[model samples]
Target: MKQDIDIPKVEGVYVAIVNEYNDIYKTQDWNAYIINDNDDALEMVIIVTDGYSEDKITSKFRKKIDVLPKKSYAKIELMQEELFAVNNQFKVTYFKGNTMYDKVYTFRKNTINLKALQPVPLMEARGVLVK
Candidate 1:
Protein backbone atom coordinates (compact mmCIF):
# COMPACT_ATOMS: atom_id res chain seq x y z
CA MET A 1 0.00 0.00 0.00
CA LYS A 2 1.22 3.50 -0.78
CA GLN A 3 0.26 4.78 2.65
CA ASP A 4 2.27 2.08 4.39
CA ILE A 5 5.38 2.97 2.45
CA ASP A 6 5.00 6.66 3.26
CA ILE A 7 4.65 6.04 6.97
CA PRO A 8 8.31 5.03 7.35
CA LYS A 9 9.48 8.38 6.03
CA VAL A 10 7.83 10.47 8.72
CA GLU A 11 9.63 9.13 11.75
CA GLY A 12 11.76 11.19 14.16
CA VAL A 13 15.45 10.94 15.05
CA TYR A 14 17.55 11.01 18.26
CA VAL A 15 20.67 13.03 19.13
CA ALA A 16 22.90 13.18 22.22
CA ILE A 17 24.82 15.77 24.26
CA VAL A 18 27.04 15.92 27.34
CA ASN A 19 26.61 18.51 30.05
CA GLU A 20 29.37 20.23 32.00
CA TYR A 21 29.48 17.43 34.55
CA ASN A 22 30.27 14.88 31.82
CA ASP A 23 26.69 13.77 31.98
CA ILE A 24 24.77 13.16 28.77
CA TYR A 25 21.45 14.69 27.74
CA LYS A 26 19.10 13.54 25.00
CA THR A 27 16.64 15.66 23.04
CA GLN A 28 12.97 15.01 22.43
CA ASP A 29 11.68 13.00 19.47
CA TRP A 30 12.93 15.19 16.65
CA ASN A 31 10.27 14.84 13.99
CA ALA A 32 11.21 15.97 10.51
CA TYR A 33 8.21 18.26 10.39
CA ILE A 34 8.88 19.63 13.86
CA ILE A 35 12.58 20.40 13.34
CA ASN A 36 11.57 23.24 11.04
CA ASP A 37 9.67 25.06 13.76
CA ASN A 38 12.26 26.07 16.34
CA ASP A 39 15.11 28.50 15.67
CA ASP A 40 16.21 29.52 19.14
CA ALA A 41 16.85 25.93 20.13
CA LEU A 42 20.31 24.45 19.66
CA GLU A 43 20.64 23.04 16.18
CA MET A 44 24.14 21.64 16.47
CA VAL A 45 25.99 20.05 19.41
CA ILE A 46 29.69 19.47 19.91
CA ILE A 47 30.84 15.89 20.29
CA VAL A 48 33.39 16.29 23.08
CA THR A 49 35.72 13.36 22.78
CA ASP A 50 37.92 12.12 25.61
CA GLY A 51 40.98 13.50 23.78
CA TYR A 52 39.72 17.10 23.32
CA SER A 53 37.39 17.32 26.30
CA GLU A 54 39.94 18.71 28.71
CA ASP A 55 41.06 21.77 26.78
CA LYS A 56 38.06 23.13 24.83
CA ILE A 57 35.56 21.70 27.29
CA THR A 58 35.27 22.49 30.95
CA SER A 59 34.07 20.52 33.92
CA LYS A 60 31.76 23.41 34.78
CA PHE A 61 29.45 24.74 32.07
CA ARG A 62 31.93 27.32 30.86
CA LYS A 63 29.97 28.95 28.02
CA LYS A 64 30.84 26.14 25.61
CA ILE A 65 29.22 26.27 22.18
CA ASP A 66 27.63 22.92 21.52
CA VAL A 67 28.46 21.13 18.26
CA LEU A 68 26.10 19.48 15.84
CA PRO A 69 27.29 19.77 12.22
CA LYS A 70 29.36 22.37 10.36
CA LYS A 71 30.23 23.79 6.96
CA SER A 72 33.31 22.43 5.23
CA TYR A 73 35.17 25.73 5.68
CA ALA A 74 33.97 28.46 8.01
CA LYS A 75 35.29 30.28 11.05
CA ILE A 76 32.13 31.96 12.39
CA GLU A 77 28.45 31.18 12.16
CA LEU A 78 25.23 32.35 13.80
CA MET A 79 23.41 30.09 16.24
CA GLN A 80 20.23 31.06 18.06
CA GLU A 81 21.03 34.55 16.74
CA GLU A 82 24.03 34.75 19.08
CA LEU A 83 27.58 35.42 17.87
CA PHE A 84 29.35 32.42 19.36
CA ALA A 85 33.12 32.34 19.35
CA VAL A 86 34.31 29.55 17.05
CA ASN A 87 37.50 29.13 19.05
CA ASN A 88 35.95 28.16 22.37
CA GLN A 89 32.98 26.33 20.87
CA PHE A 90 33.62 24.07 17.90
CA LYS A 91 29.95 23.67 16.96
CA VAL A 92 28.42 25.54 14.01
CA THR A 93 24.90 26.80 13.21
CA TYR A 94 23.08 27.82 10.05
CA PHE A 95 23.33 31.29 8.53
CA LYS A 96 19.93 31.48 6.82
CA GLY A 97 16.49 31.43 8.39
CA ASN A 98 14.52 30.28 5.34
CA THR A 99 17.10 28.00 3.78
CA MET A 100 18.06 24.89 5.73
CA TYR A 101 20.67 23.11 3.62
CA ASP A 102 23.61 23.71 5.94
CA LYS A 103 25.25 21.11 8.19
CA VAL A 104 22.81 21.92 10.97
CA TYR A 105 19.78 20.72 9.01
CA THR A 106 21.50 17.65 7.56
CA PHE A 107 21.84 16.09 10.97
CA ARG A 108 18.22 17.00 11.70
CA LYS A 109 16.84 15.41 8.55
CA ASN A 110 18.51 12.05 9.10
CA THR A 111 15.97 9.35 9.85
CA ILE A 112 18.03 8.14 12.79
CA ASN A 113 20.05 11.06 14.10
CA LEU A 114 22.64 10.78 16.87
CA LYS A 115 23.37 14.48 17.24
CA ALA A 116 20.05 15.22 18.91
CA LEU A 117 20.32 12.51 21.52
CA GLN A 118 22.06 13.19 24.85
CA PRO A 119 23.40 10.33 26.97
CA VAL A 120 23.41 11.39 30.62
CA PRO A 121 23.91 9.63 33.89
CA LEU A 122 20.74 7.77 34.82
CA MET A 123 20.54 9.24 38.30
CA GLU A 124 21.09 12.83 37.19
CA ALA A 125 19.16 12.55 33.93
CA ARG A 126 15.84 11.64 35.52
CA GLY A 127 13.05 14.16 35.13
CA VAL A 128 11.02 15.83 37.87
CA LEU A 129 7.73 17.31 36.79
CA VAL A 130 6.92 20.70 38.31
CA LYS A 131 3.28 20.71 37.39
Candidate 2:
Protein backbone atom coordinates (compact mmCIF):
# COMPACT_ATOMS: atom_id res chain seq x y z
CA MET A 1 0.00 0.00 0.00
CA LYS A 2 2.88 2.36 0.57
CA GLN A 3 4.00 1.99 -2.99
CA ASP A 4 0.48 2.60 -4.27
CA ILE A 5 0.24 5.94 -2.53
CA ASP A 6 1.15 8.73 -4.89
CA ILE A 7 2.89 11.40 -2.91
CA PRO A 8 3.41 14.13 -5.40
CA LYS A 9 6.63 16.10 -5.19
CA VAL A 10 6.47 19.78 -4.40
CA GLU A 11 8.09 21.95 -7.04
CA GLY A 12 8.64 25.62 -7.79
CA VAL A 13 7.51 26.81 -4.38
CA TYR A 14 9.97 28.50 -2.04
CA VAL A 15 10.45 30.51 1.15
CA ALA A 16 12.56 33.62 1.09
CA ILE A 17 13.95 35.85 3.85
CA VAL A 18 14.31 39.37 2.54
CA ASN A 19 16.03 42.43 3.95
CA GLU A 20 14.32 45.53 2.73
CA TYR A 21 13.71 49.10 3.77
CA ASN A 22 10.54 49.56 5.79
CA ASP A 23 8.97 52.87 4.85
CA ILE A 24 6.68 52.98 7.83
CA TYR A 25 9.35 52.06 10.34
CA LYS A 26 12.11 53.98 8.53
CA THR A 27 14.57 51.11 8.80
CA GLN A 28 15.66 47.95 7.10
CA ASP A 29 14.07 44.76 8.33
CA TRP A 30 14.07 41.07 7.52
CA ASN A 31 10.81 39.57 6.35
CA ALA A 32 9.66 36.11 5.27
CA TYR A 33 7.77 35.44 2.08
CA ILE A 34 6.15 32.46 0.38
CA ILE A 35 6.74 32.35 -3.33
CA ASN A 36 4.60 30.32 -5.72
CA ASP A 37 6.62 29.85 -8.88
CA ASN A 38 4.48 27.09 -10.30
CA ASP A 39 2.23 27.70 -13.27
CA ASP A 40 -0.77 26.38 -11.35
CA ALA A 41 -2.37 28.09 -8.40
CA LEU A 42 -2.12 26.71 -4.90
CA GLU A 43 -5.03 26.55 -2.44
CA MET A 44 -5.38 26.37 1.33
CA VAL A 45 -1.77 27.22 1.88
CA ILE A 46 -0.39 27.04 5.40
CA ILE A 47 3.02 27.94 6.71
CA VAL A 48 4.40 27.21 10.17
CA THR A 49 7.60 28.97 11.12
CA ASP A 50 10.05 28.95 13.99
CA GLY A 51 13.67 29.54 14.94
CA TYR A 52 15.87 27.51 17.23
CA SER A 53 19.42 26.84 18.32
CA GLU A 54 21.29 24.98 21.01
CA ASP A 55 20.20 27.17 23.91
CA LYS A 56 17.44 29.38 22.52
CA ILE A 57 14.16 28.88 20.72
CA THR A 58 11.76 31.43 19.30
CA SER A 59 8.00 31.14 19.38
CA LYS A 60 6.28 29.15 16.66
CA PHE A 61 3.73 30.81 14.42
CA ARG A 62 1.29 29.76 11.73
CA LYS A 63 -0.06 31.62 8.71
CA LYS A 64 -2.89 30.63 6.41
CA ILE A 65 -3.61 31.80 2.93
CA ASP A 66 -6.82 30.78 1.17
CA VAL A 67 -5.20 30.92 -2.26
CA LEU A 68 -1.82 31.71 -3.74
CA PRO A 69 -2.08 32.68 -7.37
CA LYS A 70 0.32 31.29 -9.90
CA LYS A 71 3.66 33.06 -10.03
CA SER A 72 2.84 35.18 -7.04
CA TYR A 73 4.05 35.67 -3.48
CA ALA A 74 2.76 36.67 -0.05
CA LYS A 75 4.47 38.09 3.00
CA ILE A 76 4.39 35.59 5.85
CA GLU A 77 6.04 37.47 8.74
CA LEU A 78 8.87 39.63 9.94
CA MET A 79 12.11 38.08 11.10
CA GLN A 80 13.72 39.53 14.18
CA GLU A 81 17.38 40.45 13.72
CA GLU A 82 18.43 38.37 16.70
CA LEU A 83 16.82 35.24 15.29
CA PHE A 84 19.32 35.29 12.44
CA ALA A 85 21.82 33.63 14.74
CA VAL A 86 19.61 30.58 15.00
CA ASN A 87 18.21 28.13 12.50
CA ASN A 88 14.96 29.35 10.94
CA GLN A 89 12.51 26.79 9.65
CA PHE A 90 9.33 27.13 7.63
CA LYS A 91 6.97 24.26 6.90
CA VAL A 92 4.75 24.95 3.92
CA THR A 93 1.72 22.88 2.93
CA TYR A 94 -0.67 23.53 0.10
CA PHE A 95 -2.91 21.93 -2.54
CA LYS A 96 -2.37 22.01 -6.26
CA GLY A 97 -5.54 21.08 -8.05
CA ASN A 98 -6.92 18.19 -5.96
CA THR A 99 -3.62 16.84 -4.66
CA MET A 100 -1.73 17.89 -1.57
CA TYR A 101 1.96 18.72 -1.22
CA ASP A 102 4.24 20.01 1.50
CA LYS A 103 7.83 21.00 2.04
CA VAL A 104 10.10 22.43 4.70
CA TYR A 105 12.51 25.26 4.03
CA THR A 106 15.29 26.09 6.43
CA PHE A 107 17.84 28.88 6.78
CA ARG A 108 20.83 27.65 8.66
CA LYS A 109 22.23 29.62 11.58
CA ASN A 110 23.94 32.86 10.53
CA THR A 111 23.10 32.19 6.88
CA ILE A 112 20.41 34.82 6.37
CA ASN A 113 22.57 37.92 6.30
CA LEU A 114 22.45 40.60 3.66
CA LYS A 115 25.59 39.35 1.94
CA ALA A 116 23.75 36.17 0.89
CA LEU A 117 20.89 37.86 -0.94
CA GLN A 118 20.01 36.83 -4.47
CA PRO A 119 17.38 37.74 -7.02
CA VAL A 120 14.18 36.00 -5.99
CA PRO A 121 11.75 34.83 -8.65
CA LEU A 122 8.45 36.79 -8.94
CA MET A 123 9.79 39.43 -6.62
CA GLU A 124 11.50 42.72 -7.30
CA ALA A 125 13.60 42.67 -4.17
CA ARG A 126 16.42 40.24 -3.55
CA GLY A 127 16.71 37.84 -0.59
CA VAL A 128 17.93 34.47 0.63
CA LEU A 129 15.79 31.84 -1.03
CA VAL A 130 15.54 28.16 -0.16
CA LYS A 131 14.27 25.77 -2.77
In terms of TM-score, the best-performing candidate is 2
Point out the worst 10-residue segment of candidate 1 by lDDT. 77-86
Best by lDDT: 2
Tens digit of per-residue lDDT, candidate 1, span 1-131: 75643222111222222212222444242211112122233343322211122234322121223332322211122121111111222222232323322222222112122333343322233211110
Q: What is the lDDT of candidate 2?
A: 0.93
Candidate models: Cα lDDT each = 0.23, 0.93
* CA lDDT, candidate 1, residue 58: 27
